[model samples]
Target chain A: MLSSTVTSLTVLLIVVFLFKEGVGVFDKTAMEEGFVIAINKNNPVDKLSSEQIKNIYDQKIISWEEVGGKKDSIFLFRVDDISNFYTDEQIGENFEMLPYRLSSLVDSFPGVIAFFPEKYLDKNFKGKKLEADKVTLAEFFGGEEWFPTAHPSAQLGVKPLILGTLWVSLGAILLALPLALAAAIYMSEIAKERVRRIMKPLIELLAGIPSVVYGFFGLVVIVPLIQSTFGVAVGETGLAGSIILGIMALPTIITISEDAMRNTPRAMKEASLALGASKWQTIYRVVIPHSISGISAGAILGIGRAIGETMAVLMVTGNAAVIPHGILEPMRTIPATIAAELGEAPNGGLHYKALFALGCVLFIITLFLNLTVEFISNRKKAHKH
Target chain B: MYQIDENKVTRKKKRNQKFVFFLFGAMGYFVVALLVLILTFIIYKGASAISWDFITKMPEEGMTKGGIFPAIIGTLCLVAGSMLFAFPIGVLAAIYMNEYVKDGFIKKFIKQMTNNLAGIPSIVFGLFGMSLFVNKLGFGDSILAGSLTLGLLALPVVIRTTEEALKAVDNTFRQASIGLGASKWQTTRRVVLPIAFPNIITGLILSVGRVSGETAPILFTVAAYFLPKLPTSIFDQAMALPYHLYVISTSGTNIEESRPIAYGTALVLVIIVLFTNLLANGLRKYFSKKVKMN
Candidate 1:
C-alpha cells in the first residue's frame, strides 16, 4: 500500500512540476518578472518587437539595417559572458556595481543588445530598455511557425508538431492494425500449439529489442530503401518513422488481442462448429465479435506506443517542424521535439518552458488514450462477470 | 439440380477458407521474417567493427575512434541504480496487493494506477525527471537523477510482474502454513515468498532489460553528449550507450566515419538485451520444472 502511494505521489509531483515550468511562457512582460533586454541608446532603433529580438539573437537579422538602425552589425551580449564583461574581483567587491557596469558596457557598443535581470536596469542608464510583449496563449496554440528562438520574437506555435505527430501515429496504426489483427487471429485460432510455442517467443523478443537499435536499422536500411523506392531527395520522411513505429507496435497488439481471442468460451466455438459453420466462419462470426473490446484495447495500446515513441522516430523523421502534407514528407513529433531540444534550452527560460509545455501536451494525449483502454477492458470484464 | 448447387457452394466455401488460411499464414511468416532480417542485418553490418580493443579503451579523436568502455560502465551503473530502487518497492507493493488487500476497491484502484503509469510516454518521464530531479531537486544532470527517473519508469512493470508471480503461487500452501499456527506475516514471508522467489527474479531480469534499453527517460536526466571519463559517483555526468548511438548516427561531426561505430554499439546493446531475455526464459522453465517435482 505504501509503495503504491509513493508511486501515485511521484506521478502527481511530476505533473505539478511540469505544469509549473511549462506555464511560465505566458508571462507578458519579462521585465516585471525579473528579466529585461537593454540595447545601446545611440542606435536608431527606438523599440523592437519580440519577433525582432529573437531574430537578432538568432543572428538572422545580422545587419542593423534590417532592424531600422545605422548600417552596422548587431553584437549580442549576455551577462554570463564574464570574460568579456567583468572580472571576479569587481563582482565580488560590490554587487551593485554590476548593473552600472552593464549600463556602461551597453553604452560602449553602438550596435549591441544585452539581456539581464530587471534589478540590474538603471533608470538614467545610457542604454534603453525595451518592453517585451507578452506571449499570448493563441500564439502558442495556433501559431503556424515554431521558430522559438527567432530574432525579435520567439515563435511557440505547436501546430506543425501536433499535425506531424498525428500523421505519423495515424499512418503507423493504419499499417500495423491489419497485420497485427491477422497475426492475432492466426496465433489464437488457426496455428497449431507447436507453431504458437515457437512464434510467441519470437514476437516477445521483438518487443525486447531496444528502440535505438530500431532507429539505427531505420537509418541504414529503411531510410535508403524508401529513398530509392520513392526517388525522393531524402529518405528521412514521416513514412520511415511510421514504418518503424508500426513494426515496434506489432508486439503489443499481437499479445493483447491474441489473449483476448484465446479467452473466448470453448462451448461457444463448439456450438458454432456444431451448427454447420466452417472453421473460419465460427472465428469471424463468434470469436471476433466476442473479443472486439479486447481487440480495440490492443489497438489503443499500440497507438499509445506509436505516439509516445521517441528515439526511433527522432532518428528517421528528419526532425523538420513542418506540417507534413503527405506520408513521404519530412516531419517531427512532439516527443521527438522535446527530446531533441530540452538539452539546449536554458533552465527556466521561455524555450525551456515551451519544451515542458510540449511535454504536457504529450502527457495529456497518452493519458487520455490509456484511460480509454482501461475503460474498455474494465467494461469487458464487467460484461463477463 | 439442387444437389449440384449445394456441391458448388461447398466448393466455393472451401476455396474461401484456403485463401483466408493462406493470408493468415503469410502474415505470421512476415512478422517472423522481419525479426530474422533485422538480427542478421545488424550482425552482418556490425561484425567487422567488433574488436576487443574497441570494447576496452576510451573513445579518442572526437569519438571517431577507440572503444566504448565508459558508455558500457555508465549503462551498467544506470541498470544497477534503477534496480536498487525499483526492486524492493515493487515487491512490497505486490505483496500488499496480492496478500494483504482483499480484491476490493483499493486493490482495483492501485492496479488501474499501475496500468496508467506503464502507459505514460517515456519522454514525458524525461521532462518530469529534468524538472523534478535535475532542476528542482538540484541533482543536476547526474546518474542518481537518471536512475530515479528510470526506476519510476520500470516500477509499473516490476509491480505488475511481481503481482502475477505472487498470485501464481498456489493458495493451498498459504492456507496450510496459516493452519499450522503461523502468523499471517510469517506465512507470507516463509511460505509464499519462497515459492514466488524464482518468478520474482524473472521479473527483475525483465526490468533490467527494460532499464538498460531505455533512452528518452535518461536523455535529459543524466546522459551526457560526450564524457571521456567513467563516473566515480552518482552525481557525476556520464555517457550512456543508447545516447551515444543516437548522437553518432544522427548528429556527429563525421557521420560517415562513425557509422561503423554506431553499428557496433547497436550490436552490443542488442546482445545484452537478448541475453537477459533468454536468461529470464531459462529461469522460468527451470523453476516451473522444480515446482512440478514438488
Candidate 2:
C-alpha cells in the first residue's frame, strides 16, 4: 500500500510538471508576438457584415466580385498541400503546415480573406499595402468576430470563445444531472442486488468508451435528429453538443453516487422503514441525506467530465467562436478551442500561451472539485465520529 | 387454521409473488435495454466494414476508408511499453507502502497525494507528456514518449489496486511464514505476492485496456498522421488507433463519408476492452478457486 501510494503520488507530480510546461510554452509564445490582423489584399475592406464573412468562410461566395474585390475567382488558400489552393513550395521550405496554416493562407491570398497568428505576421506581412485600413485586427476580434488563430492579433476582437465554452458546459450539466441522479437513486436504493451488479458495470463501461466514439455517434444520430426536429438547415449547434456531453456524463454521475448511496449504513434505512415510512420516503428522507455529500461530489465530477470533454464537443459544436444566442445556436468551448488549435499554434508563442491560460482555468476548476470531494468525505467521516 | 382465515393468507401470498416478479423484470429490462441499444448499433454499423484486407491494411488518402493495421500495432507498442516501465516500479511502490514504514506523516501525505492524482484530468497528463517527455527529453514524436506518458497515467491506478490486493491477503499467512523461521523478504516473496498475483493481474489488465483507448494525452504525444509501415523501434513514430479514430471523426468533413471507418474502429476498440475485462474476470475466478482449494 505504501509503495503504491508513492507511485501514484509520483504520477500526480508528473501531471503538475505537464501543466507547468504547457503553460510555460504558451507564456513565451504570447510575449514574443502581441497581436496583428492580416487581411486579404484583393478583398481589402473597411468592414464586412457577419453574413458576408460567413459566406466567404463557407466558400459560398467564391468570387472576389461578390465582396467588392477583383472579378477573378477567390482561391481559398490553406498552409498545407492537403488543399489545392496553395502549393507546398509557396509556404516556404522550412514551414511545416501546422493546423494554423489555413488561417495564414486566408490572410495572404489576394482574392482570399482569412486570419493568421499575430506573431507570424512579421513587419513584411502586416506592412503589405491594403486598399483600406478601416478593418483592424482589434475590431475583428473585439467587435464580436471570433476567429481564434494562433497570433493574439488575429482574435478579431471577440470574447465569444470564452463565453461559448462556459455556456455549453453549463447547459450539458443542467441537462444531465437530474436524469443521472434519478437513475442512481433507482439503481442503488430500489433495485435488487442481481440487477444492481449488472446495471452498474454496464453504466461504468459507458464511461470507459472513448469520447471520439461519442462524437461519431453524435454526428450520425443526434445532429440529424436535431435538424429534423427543430426545422433547421444544420443541426450542429450548442444543443447538440450539450446533449451529447450530457449523455457521456450520465454514467459517471450515476455510478459514483450509486456506490456512495449503497455504502450508506443499512441501519438508517431500516430505522426509517420501522418508523412507518414508505419505501420511497425512506429512500428520500433517510438514505439520500446520509449520502448527500457523495451525490454532490459525483455531480462535481460529472461537471469536470463535461468541461474536459474535447472531441465530441468539437465535432458537433460547429467550431464557431461566438457566444451562443440560444441553446440551438452553434458555439465553442474552452476544451474544444484548445483541441482545435493547439496542433497549429507555433511553439512558444502568445497564441499558444492563451491556450495554456485556458488550460490553467480548466485545471483550477477540476482541482477545486476533487479537493472539495476529499474535503466533504473527510467532513462526513468526522461527523460520524 | 380456521377456514375463514385461509382466503386472506392466499391473497397475501399471491400479491407478494406478483410484486417480486415485477421487481425482477423491471430491473432486468433496464439493463437489457441499454445493452441492446449500444451493442446492436455498433455491430449493425461496423460488421459490413470488417474484412481480412481491411484489418491487415493501412489508412490512405481521402477523408475516409482504409485498414487499421498500423493503429493496431501502435496500440500494442504503447501498452507493452507502458507495462515494461510501470510494472516493476508500481510493484515496488506497493511493497513499500504495505510492508515498510509504520503509520506516520509521510505515509498520510502520500495517501492524500495519490487520491488527488487519480482524479486529475487526462488532458493535463497529455500536456505534461508534451513538455517533459516529448520536448525537454527530446523524444520528439516517438512511441517512447507516448509510452512514458501513458505509463505515468497508469501508475496511480496500478499502485492503488496493488495495495488493495496486498491488504486483502490474510495477516496470518505472514505470521506463519515467519514462524517457520523464514526471513521477512522470503515470506513476502513466497507467501504474500503469490496470493496477490491474481489481483495484480486484474489491475494490470484494466490498466492496459485504458491505455489502449486513451486519446487526449496521445493526441499531443503520439504520431497523428497515418503510418503505412509498422514502427520498428520505440523511438520511431507510430499512429495510435484512438487518435486515428478521433482524427477521422472530426476532420471537419461530413459524417456520411466517415461513418464506416468510425464504426469499424469503435467495434474493434469495444472488442478489445471487453476481451480484457473477460480475461481479468477469468484470472480472478481461477485465483479464487485456488484459494478455495488451499
Candidate 3:
C-alpha cells in the first residue's frame, strides 16, 4: 500500500514538471511576439507597413531596387562562417553546413539580402546594422515568414510551419479512417483464429519498426508510386503523406478492434445466429454494433498516431509551408515542422516558444481524443449494465 | 425415416466447406504477404551492411559517415533504466490490486485505467514526458528522464502482466501453503512468486524490447545527438538507435551514403526485438511443458 502511494506520487510530480516547462514556453512566446521592437540604422526603410514587411521577409522584395536602397544591385551582407547559426559543432567542423555560411552564399549572389542568428553576426558585415529596438523587432515578429537563422534579434516568422502542420495531419486522418475500419473488420470478424494468431503479431511487429524506416520507405516506394499513378512531376504532397500514415495506422486499428470484437460475449453471436441471420449478416449487424465503441477508440488513437508522426511525413510530404487546398498539394504537419525547426530555434526566443505552443496544441488534441474515448466507453458500459 | 434429403444436405455442406476454405486461404495469404513484404525488404537492404567495422565506429558530423555505437548503448541504457524504475512499482501495484484488495470501486477503476493506458498512442506519452519528466522534474534531456518517461510508458503493461501471472497461480498452492501454517506473505513470496517468476520474466523482456524500439518518448525526453563520447554517469547525455536512424533517413547529409548506416541500425534493432520475443516464447513453452509433466 505504501509503495503504491509512493508510485502515484512520483507520477504526479513528473506530470507537474512537464506542464511547468510547457507553460514556460507559452509565456515566452506571448511576451516576445505580443510586444517587442527593432531598429535598422544602415537603411532608412525600417519604417514600413506590415504588408511591406511580409513581402520583404518572404523574399519577394529581393533587391534594394525593389525596396529602395543604395543601387539597383543590393550589396547584401550576412554572417560569416559561424557555428551558432545551426550545427552544434565546432566552427571548423560545421562551417560547411552552417546556415550563416549558406546565408553568405545567398549574400554573394546578385540582388540577395539574407540574415542569420544574432550570435553568428559580427563586425565583418557591411550592409544593414539592425539595432536592438523593441518596436522594430516586434514589427519583424509580425511577419508571416520563418527563417530561424536570420541575423539580428528580429525577423523570424512561424506562420508557414504552423499552417503546414495542420494541412498534412488533416489530410492523413481523412485518408486513414475508412480503410483502417474496413481492414479491422476483416481481420477481427472474418479471419480464422489461426490466421489471426499469425497476422496479429506480424502487424504489431510492423508497429515496432522505427519511424525512420517508414520515412525511407515512404521516400523510396510511396513517392514513386504516387508520381507514376498520378502523373505528377513531384510525388511529395499531402496525398502521399496520407497514404504512408494510413499504412502506419493499420496495425493499431486492427489490433484494438479485434480485442473489442473478441470481448463481445459468445451469447450475443449465438443469439444472432439463432435468429436465422447469415454469417456476414451476423457479423455486420451483431458483432460490429457491439464493438462500435472500441472501433471509435481505435480510430481516434490511429488519428493521434497520424498527427504525431514526424520523419516519414517530413520526408515525403514535400514540406511546403502552405495551407493545402487539395490532397495533391504539398503540405506539412505540426510534428514535422516542430522537429524541423526546434533544434535551430533560440532557447528562450519567440520562435522556440511558438514551437512549444504547437506541441501544446498537439498535446491537447491527443488528450481530448483519449479522454473522450474513455468517457464514451464508460458511458457505453453503464448503458449496457 | 421418410424420404431422406441426403443429396440436398450433401450439396449444402460442400458449398459451406468450399466457402470456409476460400476464406481461410485468403486470410493466410494476407498474413504471409505482410511478413514477406516487410521482412524481405529489410533483410535485402540491411544484411549487406552488417559488418564488424560498422558495429564499432562512432558517427561523424554527417549521418552518412558514421556508425551506431552510441545508439546501441543508449538503447541498452533506456531498457535497463526503464526496467529498474518500472518493475518493482508495477509488480507491487499488481500484488496490491490482485492479491490484497477486495473487489470494489477503486479496483474496478484501476482495471479500467490500466486498459485505457494500454490503448493510449505513444505520442501522448511523449507529450506527457516532455511536460512531466524532462522539464518539470528538471532532468533535462538525460538518460534518467528518458527512462522515467519510458517507465511510465511500460508501467501499465507490467502491471497487467504481473496481475495475470499472479491470478494464474493455482489456488490450491496458496491454500496448501496456508495449510502448512505459512502466513499470507510467506505463501505469496515462496510459492506464488516462484511459480509466476517465468511469466514475469517474459513480461519484463517484452517490455524491455518495446522500450528499446520506442522513438517518440525518447525524442522528447533524452535527445542526445552525434555524441561520440559514451555517457560516464547517469545524468550524461547519450544517443539512441531509433533517433539515429530517424536522423540518418530524414535530414540525411547524403541518402546514398547513409544507406549502409541505416541498414546496420535497422538490422541491430530487429535482432533485439526478435530475440526478446523468442526469449519470452521459449520461457512460456518451457513452463507449460513443466506444468504438463507435473
The model with the greatest DockQ is: 1
lDDT of every model, 2 decimals: 0.88, 0.72, 0.68
The residue-by-residue lDDT of candidate 2 on A152-244, one tens digit each, is 223433357667766778888898787777778778776778867777767767766667777777887889899999998789999899888
User: Order of candidates by lDDT, top first?
Assistant: 1, 2, 3
lDDT of 3 at B199: 90
lDDT of model 1 at position B33:
89
lDDT of 3 by residue, B24-107 (tens): 456545544754676677778888887776777777757776577778888888889989998998899888887788899877
> What would the per-residue lDDT of candidate 2 be over residues B86-111, giving only the tens digit for each residue?
77777787777787757898677777
Supply the TM-score for candidate 2. Answer: 0.77
lDDT of 2: 0.72
Ranked by DockQ from best down, the candidates are 1, 2, 3
Of the two candidates 1 and 2, the one with more favorable TM-score, higher being better, is: 1
Which sections of candidate 1 miss by over 4 Å? A28-133, B1-4
Off by over 4 Å in 2: A1-162, B1-32, B60-65, B252-255
**Deviation (Å) of A106 in candidate 2:** 28
